[model samples]
Target: MGVVIPLEENKNKHASVKPLVDLTKPGMERVNQLILSKAGSDVQMIPEVANHLISSGGKRLRPMLTLASAALFDYQGDADVKLATSVEFMHTATLLHDDVVDESDLRRGKSTARMIWGNQASVLVGDFLLGQAFRMMVDVGSLEALDVLSTAATVIAEGEVLQLSVAKNMETTEDDYLQVIRAKTAALFAAAAEVGPIVAKADKAGRNALKSYGMNLGLAFQLVDDALDYGGKSADLGKNTGDDFREGKITLPVILSYRRGTPAERAFWREAIEGGKSDDAQLEKAMGLITKYSGLSDTIARAVHYGEMARDALAPLPESDWKAALMEVIDFCIERAN
Candidate 1:
């Protein structure tokens, strides 16, 4: 079982009540229905898996951005809802494949698709979702939107492969890590926000503004996610702490910790991370070294820096509730413990 913690003790306690766009609002409801319809009837078991994943619940941050961006432009049509669902399908597909690729057993506090259904089934179902997303795109009839989503999917796939290759590759630099993040996580976020303007038929400048907003937000979000694995609880984060290191994935905290440690400390990390499998004593020693070297503080600082960048990206947007909400979301990206 995963570690359990009280929700009331979460780091961002106040954020739990933060305002969000009512996803059940009439237009948003239409979007949810259309998303299910567009997902299509796959082989019986496959569609069931997709549905299970969808219903498992996430913050739906990407689709929420799409809806907020569309509302900002006063989009009257309900096509925005369908488009939002399309973005979600694409996001979900990536998650399914990501679990398989990483050999992950847990996601959102539940057994991962790969753990429950086997790797082959999980991967094949992921492909089915990707195809369904494209069909939804075709229905939208926006060639520009189709192009953007397709390119994002390709980049995300490449990014996943690159991260896998760099696993336990001690020479991996911060720049290399950021590049992987941009491709794997930010590209889709950029596309998610960019689609809103296209659907609303906003002009070039307006569309670019939304794209920038999503890009920076995604960067901040992923950095914090990486940092939390080392410093957070399973009940709060929906996954086990140290799973990244246990799986031989060297993330920002580990990288910085090794870089700042003594030569002997660094060598120990190389054995623990690169050579794989750290005994309890070694893991405890590594955690102490990381704390002494201040790598955890550095990682958190980096997340805050990017969070500021995400907020600044929204300066181009006018003053509105949605704009303020977007800023709050950026803060939540870094401040959230879960």
Candidate 2:
């Protein structure tokens, strides 16, 4: 319960993605319609599983980034809608597959699809979503966009594999953790933002700017998620506290705590994390070690670093409400860890 990080202390005002939501609402409606239509399958259970997760509360931030980036340039085409939906499908597919891999029972504070229908069903439905995502990418008819997203999809899978390879591995370093997230999370965000400029026919510099913005924003978003897991309200977490510990996943905080702790403390972490003994008591002990070592605060500090990078990424782009909204997204991410 130690939250010593002043993540947004320098900011005088709260940052809200409300402006982004308002800006993208109209486009999001189209994206939502397409999501439902495309999520459908005559197989009945397919839509059931897909819609169950889709309708569950997710910010749809990736898709909105696509829409907002495109709108920033005033692109007048329906292709961005398709691209946005494709971005969402990619994200949804990853979640379904991740739950199966993590053996997670709850997501967004509800029963995971795998929990209800079983793992085999969840994996197949995830594959279904992936197929649909590529189909939409093709329909969008932009090879550049297709290339960007497809490469991201490949990288995401690679990131997941890397994470799996490192599970319960206390030796996992900060750089190793970041590499996994860069591929698993940031790649899609980068692609989602980059393609908007590609489709809008904006210059390469603008595309690069959005891509950089997105990649950094995604990193900031996930680092905060890592911090929140150890020191955030359950409502913000969307899953039970200590799920990461229970799952034995190595995160930055754990890395810092283990590296900085006393020898006996290290032994405790190795037993709980490396030896799979993460009961409630162990969880409390682990959190204590993380706090004593400044793990939570340092993790938030890392998130703040990336949040600054995300903000600076947009500096070269011309100013607009879309740009302002995107900036708010960076702060909103860090402030959540406050």
Candidate 3:
């Protein structure tokens, strides 16, 4: 049987994200306005699809990081708002493209753009968002910030291709999975945090510190997400619990479980994952095997390791409310698994 934890304990664990959300509210309001303004277009379908995803409820964590990191140095300019909006646009564009690439039906607990508008419109709108993001970046007139975010865009694309190459390959290693998440998820996070100090004219050390914190925090966040796919509720995930299994996506839990299972168990995984027999019964069997091999617990342990690295990244920065809030974000990302 899967090890069960108390429901109230899990609820308490996820409460850490709330404070960061509350703290970033004022700056996030400006970011939201810019997001809405930029999402509008002369073409009806363009705004239709873009607004659909934008209106969907996400925590806006990336832009919040941009805002909070700027606040850490007490930046006086309004460029942070524009830059934060750009960061959010980049994120939204990625989600639109990812849903199409994954052929997913749902995202953020709503039907995906592709599901409602078709793949052509979804891809085109995603491209439009990327263009808008770059326009805003150029308006900021910071070549360094532009360079960092643009480079991240390239890395994210490469990461998507890498994940495609490894999809459903049972031999995929833990190292390989780490590279994919670093590029696809953590690269944007590093760039988002790094740009804040650049815009604020903070020293190189401060810039690197936030970047390190974001990178490690992102790794931890995705690791917890991997564990939650097996152990969490759909309400918490904003998608079906077994979506990863149905997609035959190789995640950390699957990697650990596959590596540790017996010959017969490995054979079952091959049939279920590689062979794409991921129906409800197969999903149940997969969960049982994952529980038996302690996959969920091991993945959470990995997340905790990265979370500690994130906390250590902030050790050198002078203490401030922004720094404290960012630290809490690390806790929130890991505790979501509880």
Q: Highest TM-score, which number?
A: 2
TM-score of every candidate: 0.91, 0.98, 0.96
Q: After superposition, how far is residue 244 of candidate 2 from its true place, in Å?
A: 0.4
User: What is candidate 2's lDDT per residue for 161-195, written digit by digit as tens?
Assistant: 99999999988999999999999999999999999
Find the number of clashing residue pairs for candidate 3: 0
Q: Give per-residue CA lDDT, model 1, range 1-338, as digits (tens).
A: 11122343223445421454553266566767876776557368787778767877677888888888777677777667777888898899999998887889888898998887888888888888888888878888889888988999999989999998898887888888888999999999999888888888888887888888888888877877777777777776778877787788878878888888789888888899899867667766767776777666676677667766766677877898767777777767766634
Clashes (backbone N, CA, C under 3 Å), per candidate, total: 0, 0, 0
Ranking by TM-score: 2, 3, 1
The clash number for model 1 is: 0
Better of 1 and 3 by TM-score: 3
**Candidate 1 global TM-score:** 0.91
lDDT score at residue 5, model 2, on the 0-100 scale: 53
Considering only N, C-alpha and C atoms within 3 Å, which residue pairs clash in candidate 2?
none
lDDT by candidate, in order shown:
0.78, 0.92, 0.89
For model 3, how does the per-residue alpha-carbon lDDT over 36-127 read when each residue is reduced to its tens digit? 89999999999999999998898889999998888888888888998899899999999999998899998989999999999999999999
